[model samples]
Target: MSMIFSWRRRRAGRGRAGKDEFPDMELSIPTHFRCPISLDLMKDPVTMCTGITYDRGSIEKWINAGNNTCPVTNQVLRSFDQIPNHAIRKMIQDWCVENKSYGIERIPTPRIPITPCDVSEICSRIEAAAQRQDAKKCLDLLKKMKNLAKESERNKRCIVQNGAGCALAACFELFASFSIEEYTDFLKEILSALTWTFPLGDKGKSKLGSAISLRCIALFLKGDDLSSRKHAVLVLKELISEDQDFVNSLMEIEGIVEALFQIVKVPICPTATKASLVVLYRMTLSENSEMITLKFVDMGLIPCILEILVDGDKSICEKALGILDSISSRDQGREGMYENALTMPLLIKKILRVSDMATRFVVSILWKLCMGENENAVVEAMQLGAFEKLLVVLQVGCGERTKSKVTELLKLMNLYKDELDCFASSARFKFLKRPN
Candidate 1:
């Protein structure tokens, strides 16, 4: 984001004042002389995957805005990355030099972008420092790697290949052997680095999946440092997303589930809370492990999930609802949810509140509850106005599975037709509308 501002100032003045300050050349400049995206003379021009050229700032902004298609081509981009168009940039610079009498400022040459080799060199240095037990040097290298990775997706892959995970694991092992008081801050720095470079690939995951790294990862879950805790959960979330085997490994750690439960309950960072829920959902993907479900209930995860369901952000809501759908498939989880007062209404509210993904989970949870022994969950659904919403959802539209779940709940609700006589025929639920 700061890059956008820096490019703007380097172009001329702030905002549209550059034009007013130098009005002589606006008409003389050919349309092709301007960036199609920014409508200003090219500065640091770069070509994108769509084979379209744009000023670096404008194309970057477009990608940052979550648009991965070319504005001109309207073609799906092969990659979101920008390649610097050095030839086009030279033409722009030469034109500016030719138009100096018209007050056009020749755009300065952009700094040479760091290459994969540069990141690899830094990693080599970090590894050398590690072999010598040079903690300061290794820490400095890790900081530089973090900055390089953050600069571009291309750099992230380069850093990963350079053994970032192995480097971080070495840092953890080094800190573990040191007197705790002396290396606590470096340990935090290493965890912070892990947080920033999450979702590492096979090479990195092989290193992070080691027993030492798992134990070290769990330590942050128990510590007092809020940032470290957030990093731990987010890193775990990324790991779980990539590999269910990693999720199984996490389940073996003594206090991992409890620690995750604690994170959801304590809620230091919103992202951490979402991440912990995401991890739980991922772990639940394993085969029918009744003990895991029982353990989740024992850690008091049900209320925490439901509480977060009420107030969590989109991703958090999606994950919390997903876990609820999974856990409610078991007897103990269903019993725990039934006991919580907010669980039903909030689950009902979540139907159309967050996303279709969440709506699917919500409907599935209701279906699980309704499928359980008799009308307790059904009666509760009626009390929460779920039947009306379900009917409306069925009437308008939803995914096939979601529609199936809604249909099942409606069938069960109709079984108690005598009890629902007043409720179903009444005008109370008539105002309900389907979600878009």
Candidate 2:
């Protein structure tokens, strides 16, 4: 008769005699779990053929649950499917297999195994090869560096997960080893490789792809070749247009707007909207006004922009306002696209009607905008019956210094100048007159 060993007893890996031969031996429950079908702890857990249990049901219940192991061999089983479909369980299991703690997860990649080589030493050799202009030697050293990068990436998967530091270091070494004319293709190839650019750890996975892509992009930009810079811009733009999750982070890239007009369509994500606007602002800031008016204003982006002004996120609201102010400041052929954007009367109307503090802040931003160019915003401020509110804020009894600033502003609106004396007579500067 086959001995019926309890799951715990099997995990204990004891002999049939149950005598403690190796008393202190510690056994690990395999990170790869077993199948319940064959009544065995899983050796190689496949989904259907050999179920790797995902959810480790209570061990006592799993063992007692009894229908465990490879049903094919009536023999007591060692392989069983890990059950349940919890994403965290597999993550934990993968972490264990990598010998990594949850706090530090590694992004995995396939690496060429080479003996432990000091990257710094390798970098020195690569640089020397490049200096000698020995193309063959340089190529050889580059291959070795690539191998080192691969190995480093593999090792980092369990440790750093995103391997951003390792990837950058490796890219830098490769960069040092090649002349621009000889290495442009090589850099392009590496950046294009889908396998090489991901982040290292589980936590880093979401941001890793963009981060690494940006690094490659930065390197490309530094190359003397304008064509290469253009190509790099294309790649980054493609990534932004496609990857919704990465939109916000991608917006943070420096000098990104250098390629803004190349994008024909807008990304659907709000972050992308904000990013695109930022790029637009930077590009047009110093350019001729026709570019701003013909490109952005004529394209009818103002409405979409106004919608962003109403957004609840404070930073986004502020950024939008700032961009609008930038537009207002541009020469723009001395044309009115800037006012076309602010549409002051419409905005002031919303400000008076909208109740959210954020909206009020947004209105305040519009007020500031009008205060500047001294025309479009002022006309709209006068038309919207904003004078009373402006006067009230300017007068005492509202809030803090903001009120004082508004009062000063009302003094400047000229439309209120004649009426100011009439208003001042009724309300005492008495609030200011009140004892401190």
Candidate 3:
């Protein structure tokens, strides 16, 4: 019941406010059609406990302005609750319709505010369906709940306060042990609803039992349906991002980490790829689990990550660089870095072509490889045209930190003129002189 009414002029048999049409005639509004407070047509008319009816917006403004008295009667209000004057509202709509030639549009039906009782009743039905293993009934109720929550933030809070989160979690657990082949479609609908309601920061995610969630969601990631797997990863991403305990306990869940790697490695979709990459990045960064880091390199993720860095989306490239930088800082990870023949050339190509943060990461990965306290490392980079890229950056402007790295890398590799002469002899751009 919160529609704004304003006068518009008629032009070309259409309702539009224009210079010539508005002055064609001055239409008068009935006094009863106007709010005593604002003199505007009452869109959402309501009666105060003082028996005075006013437009809801006007009365709310007057009350909010610190006057507890009725604007018309000037009598003190014992209670401030405003009851909707539906009869008056219908009259207003009828009048607007009857005045269609005057260009007044019909007001839309106002949505009744969802109460806590509504949330509780829905939650109860969902919980009962879960207990009975009625997948169809549970899906219907959860879909309704998700729709109601999407109506407004107030509805979302009411749903959570009335136990929607816990109810969804319980349903997830009840359906956990079932095979995907048997309950694939039902599980997809259920997980979608769970993910929808999961971001409320309610204690339900934790109270729903982490072990149960981790196991069930991990299994969902292996399902045949693509959307369910994607939704499962996203839900896991949001759920685990806040809890460090879950990050450490990840190793305990057999295949949870593998599922994430699979999704990141061969994602069913771009969203899934990005979400999985982000989750992996956050988990590895949050906890410096050396075992996890080594396992990442051991699984041949470095090569896969290098491919992603070469061809992924701009946002995904930045995240892939961040992940590679983290994992490549170790001895084993360093080995994995140069093990892929395309790594250095791809890294060189991206030097100045990406965002500043990505450029910095590319340089960091190179530094880790070249400065692994080995002379061959620098020579390897020089052979791959990294030397020329470094010289170009030195000639042009670059960040101070990146320039320092380039200078240090050059200093460590600086050697006899004959080393350059020898390198120049075999260079593809043999006539291309190095920048002074």
Collision count for each candidate, in order? 0, 43, 0
The lDDT for every candidate, in the order shown, is: 0.77, 0.46, 0.76
Ranking by lDDT: 1, 3, 2
> Which pairs clash in model 1?
none
Alpha carbon deviation, residue 425, candidate 2 (Å) = 21
Every model: Cα RMSD to truth: 8.4, 18.1, 8.1
Off by over 4 Å in 2: 1-265, 284-295, 298-304, 310-315, 331-342, 345-379, 382-408, 417-436
Q: Per-residue lDDT tens digits of candidate 3, residues 179-293? A: 5457767767777776656543545667444676677677778766678899888777667765656666655777777888898777788888888887788666755656778
Q: What TM-score quantifies how close candidate 3 is to the native fold?
A: 0.66
> CA lDDT of 107 in candidate 3?
73
- Cα displacement (Å) at residue 127, model 2: 9.4
Residue pairs in candidate 3 whose N, alpha carbon or C atoms collide under 3 angstroms = none
Residues 167-220, candidate 2: write the lDDT tens digits: 433443345344444666666543433234343233323333346546556566
The residue-level lDDT of candidate 3 at 345 comes to 78
Compose the digit string of candidate 1's lDDT tens values, residues 123-236. 678768877878899888887777767766656765665556666755566565654457777877887777655556676676677676777778888788888889888888
For model 1, the local distance difference test gives 0.77
